[model samples]
Target: MAGSGETSEARALGEALAALRRDCGLSQAEAGARIGMTGQGWGLYEAGKRSSLFRPDVQRRLTGALGATPEALMLQAPGGAAVSTDRPKTSHPDNAPAHGLSARGRAFEGAASDVRRLRLETDELAPWASAGTVLEYALGRWPRRGQGCVIQLQDGLRKVRLYDRADEAEMVVLGAGALDRSERIARSDVQSVSAVISRLDDA
Candidate 1:
C-alpha cells in the first residue's frame, strides 16, 4: 500500500491532470486519443478522478497529449508497489525505462529511481507531468492491441495515431509515420505501456 503521504501526492497529480484536460476542452476519452489510447485503457485514465498515474508510458502519453514536457507529467505518477523503494539509485523518468524492455521491466529499471526520488520530494513529479490524466489511444491496427507498440525507438518518443474507428477495435493516431511488420511488430520499435493490470473495466 502507498503511504499516506504518497496518497496525498497522488491526489494532487490527479487534480492537475483533470485541470489540464479541462484546459484542452476535451474529455478523458478525447485526451487518451491524443496520446493513442483506446477502449478501456484511455477511459480509465480520464475517469480516474482519484487514480494515480501508474506507468511511465502513460505519463509520456499524457505529456504528448497535453503538449507539455516530460517534467509536466512526472508528478502524476504516484508512489506504490515494491518497484518504488526497492531499487538502485536513479533519476529522470523519461530517461529511466532504458527502452527495449517490457512495460513492467521498464517501469522497474527506469521509473523506479524516479519513484524513490519522488518520495523525498513532495508528492509530485516536478509539477509538470501532472497537467492531466492524459492517455494513449489505439495508434494502429497491425498486430492487434497488446501485440504492437507505437513509439520512437531511437528517441523514445511515441509514434502513435489519434482516435479512429474500426471493426476489431478502436484506433488512435499518435504519429504519422507508424511502423509495421509482417503480421507482427518488432518490440524494439514500440514503447510497451506500463500498467498493474487488475480486472477493472473493458473497452
Candidate 2:
C-alpha cells in the first residue's frame, strides 16, 4: 500500500511538472536541454520514475528550466487550485522597424551571461546575415514571425533560419541560399528554437 501511494504521488508531481512545461510553450527536449539533460531523462521525471523528483533542489531545477517556480508546480499538482497561466507581454509592437534591435537585443548588449552566441561559418543566411556574422540568442524567448532564430534538432544538427510559424506538430521556416525554400520540420525532432536577439557583423 505504501509503495502504491508513493507511486501515485510521484505521478501527480510529474503531471504537474509536465503542465508547467506546456504552459511555458516548451517541448520535452527543450526543457531538458535547458538543464543539460536528455529528453528521455526529462521524460523519466514526467513518468514518475526518477526519485530525484522528490528533492527540493531537483524540483527547483526542473521548474526553473520551465521558467516557473516550485510554488507553481505544487499549485499545478492534483487537487491543487489557483495556478496562474498568464504569459509575458511583448515588449514592443510587431510593426517595429526591421532595422531596429529588439528590446532583448538592447538588454543583451555587452552582457556575457545567459546568452548563447553562434558565429556563422557559411553564407547560408546571406542577405539577412552572411558568413562571419555572429548571433546572440536567448533560449526561452520565442521569436516573432520573420525574425531570425536558431533551431536545434534532436539529432545534434542546428540550423539558422527565418521563423515562419508553428503549430502543435510542426514548424515552418525559410532557409537560406538555394535552399531558400519554405520547409516544414517536425516538432518532435526539434530540441529548441531560440530567438536570435542580436547579430554582429565582422568588421
What value does the lDDT take at residue 41 in candidate 1? 64
Whole-model lDDT values for every prediction: 0.38, 0.69
lDDT of 1 by residue, 80-199 (tens): 222222222344353455443222212123434322111111212112122132333222112223332333344455432222222212233222333221123344455433221111
Per-residue CA lDDT of candidate 2, range 85-184, in tens? 2222232243432111112222223434547999989887778898899999875345666778888887888888988766546778886553367888
TM-score of predicted structure 1:
0.39
lDDT of 2 at 156: 80
| C-alpha RMSD values across all candidates | 16.4, 12.7
- CA shift of 53, model 2, Å: 20
Off by over 4 Å in 2: 1-112, 176-180
